[model samples]
Target: MNAFEIIGGKKLKGEIQPQGAKNEALQIISAVLLTDQKITISNIPDIKDVNKLIELLGDMGVTIERLNKDTYTFEAKNINLDFFQSDVFKTKGGGLRGSIMIVGPLLGRFGKAAIPKPGGDKIGRRRLDTHFIGFEKLGAKFIYDSKKEFFNVDATNLQGAYILLDEASVTGTANIVMAAVLAKGTTTIYNAACEPYLQQLCKMLNRMGAKISGVGSNLLTIEGVQKLGGTEHRMLPDMIEIGSFIGLAAMTESEITIKNVCYPELGVIPDVFKKLGIKFELKGDDIYIPSQKHYVIESFIDGSMLTISDAPWPGFTPDLLSIILVVATQARGNVLIHQKMFESRLFFVDKLIDMGAQIILCDPHRASVNGIDKKYKLRGISMTSPDIRAGVSLLIAALSAEGKSTIFNIEQIERGYQDIDTRLRALGAQIKRIEASAPTH
Candidate 1:
């Protein structure tokens, strides 16, 4: 148990750089297992979840050499198949949702893969049905052990086939693509997730000799090859963090420049923040958000309350809804925040309400925030982080509030953001990390 003590009402200045995409890194790191040669990756975030996956890979005999803090070269030539049967494998594999993706490359190169049920943010029901169904479509036998809560997939002689996903699941699409890259025939995936992460995955696979088309579209075609060689990859900056910084700048009336954002890859994020009346200038690839005394929430064309919701790629991401909700707390008007992807994510509004923000939790999936409009500054209180996105949202709220605020369970925040307090501190934020006293059993 760790916590952050933050003194709010101080404007954050200077520049900050977004870390490499966490979701993309997870998928790309898993893809490293597909080849035995050295695959070098740069711009990797030094975060907990990524480190956990790296440790899991090392335990499985993948040769991991750290070229630097943010660069690593992995060689899976000497993977220990027997390690898959160990308790350490099951325990570590079940710790992060991203670990489920290893099944694809494992089944492709080693003929079988097994994992305990994967864990992640408990905001909603994140099912693995899409990943398994796609694997079964590509000639894999899927089995789940009821008693042990483990899943196994065996594809000794995989042959590609057509797969129309029930929904466009990002990890599901990435998993299936990795599996299909080394299969025996052509594969077609319809309604596949085409997020930039998936596009990067497709490009990296292609660079390694996998023939994949429709790199950034709903339909993907793959001509499976006998094998794939190693390649170098650099991950895109995390768009979700960029969105959070935009919201933070507006909330605190801070002039902050986010650097090297890879502007073209940020789809619908800037527009979504624009809807909240945030003003930012793009200088090449940098996003400069100037300080503002107040920002007004925009209404629909019909003068109705604006609604900020999430959709698949080409639409606003669900990950930033929490930041949007928190930023709206100080905006000039009312807006509806709909988190369509998750059912439990909006419950954190109670903490914000306790801190003097006017928010109505409409239901499990929606929240109505009546902007304080800077009429009065929010007063801080003690609260615990609920999830990754919500944790950062709370941190933003605490930074903008008037008094001192303490946020507990900060590990949830660190799982996503890399040294968030340290980074924010560099930009003039008053945040300190304090380790909690040991718990007495």
Candidate 2:
């Protein structure tokens, strides 16, 4: 295992660019399987999860060519369907949560697909019911092999139908949309996830000759075409990372400039940070955050404590709630962080409490933070990262602490962020990666 050894209390300054969107890359890369021609994708983030998915595709006989450090061309003209039954497939496919997406494209183009139970962050009960249910609604036979812990779906003929999703699950919607785009008839999806990731997918599909409307709304209409062609796509900058940079600037009292952030696509992220009293200027396509000695949280209009919660698109993102909670530790007022999407995401607050942050974990879903207004700096401690978001949150807290801190299980953090330590070091952060010995049995 590798751990991050950091010396805190150093102000970082410089320009950092957010990587390509991880969530969107998962969907867009999987979409390449829908067409036999070469599809070029640019701005792909060099992260573990995304790379795992790409490697899975390559293992399935997709001809992948790396045009540059961040660009690739994938041609799925001769995919090996037999590989799905191999043990190597089970091990590789089961390791990444994004592997679930390939099933939709495979089932759509090849009439069948199988995947081992996917693994990802141990945040909460991330159910696959949404994906399977959507596939079943589109005339596919769904099966779960309990013995092998695998999911299988096959369709001789897919006929589109109206699908009202139980929830606006982002990955579920993307999977269903991929299958629906190749179905025999029109498919209407209501209550679909309308995040920019989905919008980019739909637009890319349209460019590939698939007919899809309602690009940026909860309702999507797809007119199935005979087949899709190849198209090029450039992923948007990761909004989660952008939000993380904002919170990091406030917590560390650092002056940083985040370059090439798609400002308009980051809906409500800037405003949400502003509500936490973090100030920044949007210049051209960059976000500039100045060093701040103190920032005060804003209260509600009716004098109630400000309650920030995650919702579907156009609302605050759940991924950044951890960042918000961490940033609130040094603010001037109190705020309630309601993590509605995931029950266990707020559990990492205990580590913050250990660091001298005044946080009350109301429950598994909510936390109330009383900002210390920089009266005292957080003292560093050794801790283990729980998930990607919480891992980054702990790193942020460590960056602003009064002494050295060690974060174990940094693999969880590397799964999302691309070269995080190197990027932070560019801004003068005293952080380094060290390999840790495995524990004995």
Candidate 3:
């Protein structure tokens, strides 16, 4: 219920580093359950969703030791399977979308796993069918307890088989890969998600003695091993946060350097931002965005409107479409944002439109933005954050606005970004966290 109070029109400067990848942290952390030995993971982000997943693991009897602020050692030697049936498990497990990943590792190691219908951003219908269907294809029995809203999977013996996924779902592919790693035979997964995070998972599993090939492609091959041993993994920098900072710098006309961005692993993120006419230079592993008074959007060679859409790996990420949309508000041209993965992700455009951005919400999946070229500054207005990406998008918009703005429900932003207010403050942003007042009865 906390909010962010920001005095806009201040330019941010200095260097900010992106935290460890949130999506990768969820999968890598869940992979600890696949083995009984100690697994060390470094560069873990200090965020709500990742912390919740770690706490859930600790509650399930994993011996977790914090080596430092961003490093942890986890041992799953004597897990208490009985805890899965406890009420505490239902409540905690159901609250996090990442909790669904535990099922594959648990089912692979313990032969059974159950989870309540997971919760996350209400962007659209995020179906669990991709996950359960993958498990079922691998010779696991799937059960849905409709009355209790629980999903249960049990496999006495898992034998690997060919799986052609309905969609290249990242979490689903990770879950199925985790399960397939310990199966009895070779498992081939076609149309798998080939994002860098997923590739990182595959490489880490290979390091842990799981035979996996096709590390950076949509097709993955895994040879099931009898057991996996301990291994160490370091997560990549969060690309979503990196993209956010790039957009933030452009919108606020600030010169900001994003350090240690893992530039090579960012896929098409930089190119996509470049299409929007945002300029930056890659100095080794860092990205430096110089202050810009105006940026223009690029159109097609045939003079058609520039359309940026989300696709699978090596394409534009859906997570940053919100940032792109927000950045497009001040650019010097028009662009169409197509949020193909999630229907409601573009709904936040209303708040930006209220702030004086010329945006037309074509539908739930697409938005057309007519950049005012900074001719009219956006006036600050109170707004509520709808999701993590949208929250940060709004915060960026507020940073470039003409007056003070209040953004309620900042918890959504905190779930993904680590110490965001502190980081922005370090860059000379006029923003502060305001705690909610206690209710009077």
Candidate 4:
């Protein structure tokens, strides 16, 4: 394992660039399998999860070329269908939550797909029933193996039909749409997830000759096509990273400029941060956060305590709630952080409380934070990161704290944020990665 030893009390004051969206990259990378032609993708993040997915695609005989650090060309001309049934396939596809998406394209083109039980952050119970259920609705036969925790779907001929998803799951919607694009007829998906990632996916699919309407709404209509062609796609900036940077600038009292944010697509992220009284200016596509002595948390109109909560897209995202909770620790006044989607995500407040923040863990899903407003800096202490978002929150807290802090299990953070330590270092933050010796049994 590796750990980050951070020297706190550094106010970062430089320009940092947000990498390509990780969530979108997962969907787009998997979409490469939908076509046999060469597709070029720009702004792909070099993160652990994405690289794992890319490696899996290569193993399946996708011709992949690296044009640059952030660019790649993929052509799925000669896929090995027999490879999906191998033991190596189980190990490769079972470890990533994003691997579930491959099922859509494989079933669309090859008429069958199989995947082991997927793995990801243990923040909450992430169910795969939505993906399977959507596939079943699209004329695919779904089977599950309880002993092996594996799932298989077979459909020789897919016929489009109307699907009302139980919930607006992001990956689930993307998977179904990818499958529907090559079906026989029209497919209507109600209550779909309309995140920018989904929008970009729809746009790219249209460019490839798939007919899809309702690009930025819950109701999406798709007319199945015979085949899809290759097209180049440039991913938007990572919205979660941008939100984290905004909170980092506020907590550390630093003036930082985030370049090339692709502002219009951010959708309610900046406004949500503004409610926390973080002062920022939007100059062209860059977000500039100015250093301030104190930022006061704003309450509701009726004088009730301000509550920052997560919901579906166009609402606050659950991913950034941890950053919001950590930022609230140093703001003026109190606020309630509610994480509705995931039950265990808010449990990390215990570590923050130990670090000298006044936090009340109301339950498994909600916490109340009383901001110190810089009356006293947080005292750094040793901690372990439970998940990706929480790890970034702890890193931000440590950066604004008083002394040295060590965060173990940084791999959780690296899975999402590309080159995090190096990026923070570029902004004048004192964070170092130390390699630890392997333990012998």
Candidate 5:
């Protein structure tokens, strides 16, 4: 096991280019299976999850040639050549949420796909009913064998149909879209997650000759194509990582610039931060965050405490709530952090509270943060990470706190971000990557 040890209370200043979205790149890489042609994807983040998915793809006989640190060219010509229950089922699909999507493409093209229950942050009971529901509507049968911990799927010549997803689940919509791209007739999908990730999927499908209308909206009309060909594509910059960078700059009161921000794709993030009293300058596609020693928290028009919450696409991302919570801690006024999507996301506040933050965990999904307002500074303390986002949030808090702090469970952080310690170090953050010699029993 490895941990990130931090010597707190240092200002972070330097330019950073946000990595390509892990979410988008994952699906784009997987969609390569739909063709025997070469699909070269650039700007892919070299993170643990991506590596795991690549490993899984390799076991399935996908030949991936790494062009550089950020480029991967994949050719799935021998698709299903190495099919085995062991190679596919043991993967932590539930964790990626996107992994469940493999069922749709595999079933539509290969007539079968065995996937284990996906695993992710135990934030809440994220239902796969929407996924199974959409696939079932498209004429795929799902066999839930809990004893085996995988979904046994089999479908023959799926037919396009009207699918009104129960909850507009992101991965659910993606699964249906993947399955429908090759189905007979037209597929009308409403309430789809048409965010950048889904948009990239649709775009790739379109390049492969899949006719898809409504590219960036909730309603996606996919004209099924007989077969999708290979096309070169690049993943979009991670909006969540950009949000993290924004929060980091605000906390450290450093003027830092974020390169290639994908200005239009970030729906409401810039405006949301402005509402929180953060100042920035957008130079073309790049964002410049200015320094602020004493930032005031924006209040509602009624002078009441402000509340920031997360929702589905076009709404704020739940992955960024931790960063927002940390930024709120440094503001001058009060704000309620509502994490509507995940039940256990707010649990990480305990670490911040111990470091002298004034926060009340109203419930599983809400926390009331009374800003320190620079009136009282935080003292550093050692803590263990609970989840991916929470772990980084703690690092941000530790960076601003006085003295020293150590973050355990580096695995969770590695699962999402790549070489985070090294990346932050480049920005002048004093952090050390340490390994724990003793194994957990």
Candidate 6:
């Protein structure tokens, strides 16, 4: 275990490029197992989750060539289909939520796949019912009991059928999409997660000869290809990272530039933050965050309070709610943050409240943050990192606090973002990565 110690109340100013998205990289890595030809992916983030998936792929005998930092070539000339029931599942799978997707491709190509209870943030009960439903629709059968926490799936001949997922579960949609790409006939997936990550996955599959229609929309039509060829692809920059940097610059009141952000597909991020009174300039693909002093919450013409919440694709992502909540603490007015996706996400507001923030946890999924502006400043406090987004949000909060702050349970943080501390440190953030406790000699 490791912790981040940060000395706060300093202006962090500089240019920092966020690594490739961890969520996208996970699916990209898993897609390698779908083909036997060479697949070259560049700008891959070297984060913990990606590394763990890479390790799992290696265990399956996927040949990998490290071209250089942030780039890798993968060829699955001969993949090891023997995914044994070993300590590997318990020790590794629980840490990676994306490991659950491996079951789809494995079952599609090899007829049988078993994944340990997939691990991820403990934010709430993110259901896998949709995943199982889609798998079952595609001629696969799943066997799992939550009490014992075991998962396995098998399908001899994947005859494609229509899959209407209960909810557009991101990983679930991805898993089904991967499996359906090689099925016997066409597969129609409705209510699919069309986030940029899923879009990239579809595009990659399409480039590999899979017929896919509607890459960025909820309705996806897939005509199974007999075989997929090796195709090179690059991942889109992380939307959450884009949102985090925007919130960071706003909170720190620093002038910064974020490069290579895809503007057309930002999906309400700019407009959502604009509602919070955070302003920035867009030059081509780069975003310029100027040093802002007074952040006033934009009131509606009706003269009521402002409320922001998350929704599905083309909607504001739930991942950035924590970051937005943290930055809103220093703004000039009040705003309500409603995180509808996951339960227990707003629970971290207690830590921010302890740091002299004016916040009221409305419920498990909602919080009312009353901004303090420059009149009050947050002081350092010790806290635990509960999940990925919450952990990074706390880090931002700690950085803007008055004194030194320590954050434990940071392995959760590493699961999503890549080298967050190092990137922040490069921009004058006083943060240090240290062990949680010393080992006995």
Q: What digit string (tens of lDDT, one per residue) describes model 6 on residues 112-201?
A: 787777777889988878878888899998787677577767788898898787788888899988888888999999999998888999
* lDDT per residue (tens digit) for residues 114-222 in model 2: 9899999999999988898898889999788999998777887999999999999999999999999999999999999999999999999999999999889999999
TM-score of each predicted structure versus truth: 0.98, 0.99, 0.98, 0.98, 0.96, 0.96
Clashing pairs in 3: none
RMSD of 4: 1.6
Q: Provide the lDDT at 249 for model 2.
A: 93
lDDT of 5 at 200: 86
- In candidate 3, where is summed lDDT lowest over 10 consecutive residues? 432-441
Deviating ranges (above 4 Å) for candidate 5: 87-97, 437-441
Lowest summed lDDT over 10 consecutive residues: which window, candidate 6? 432-441
Steric clash pairs (candidate 5): 93-118, 94-118, 94-119, 95-119, 95-120
Winner on lDDT (4 vs 5): 4
| Model 2 stretches with alpha carbons more than 4 Å out | 437-441
Off by over 4 Å in 3: 436-441
Candidate 4: clashing pairs of residues = none
What's the residue-level lDDT of 122 in candidate 2? 95
Query: Which stretch of 10 consecutive residues in model 4 shows the poorest summed lDDT?
Result: 432-441
Residue 147 of model 5, lDDT score: 82
lDDT by residue for model 1 (31-147), tens:
999999899999999999999999999999999999998999999999998887899998998888789989999987877888889998989898889999999998899788989
Question: Candidate 3: global Cα-lDDT?
Answer: 0.94
Q: State the displacement of the C-alpha of residue 345, model 4, in Å, after optimal TM-score superposition.
A: 0.7
* Candidate 4 lDDT over residue span 1-441, tens digit each: 899999999888999999999999999999999999999999999999999999999999999999999999999999998898889989988888889989999988888998999988999998887888888888999788999888878978899999999989999999999999999999999999999999999999999999999999999999999999999999999999999999999999999999999999988999988888999999999999999879999999999999989988888889999999999999999999989999999888888999999999999999999999999999998888899999999999999999998888899999999999999999999999997543332
Report every candidate's CA lDDT: 0.92, 0.94, 0.94, 0.93, 0.82, 0.85
Root-mean-square deviation of each candidate, in angstroms?
1.5, 1.2, 1.7, 1.6, 1.9, 2.3
- Reference-based TM-score, model 3: 0.98
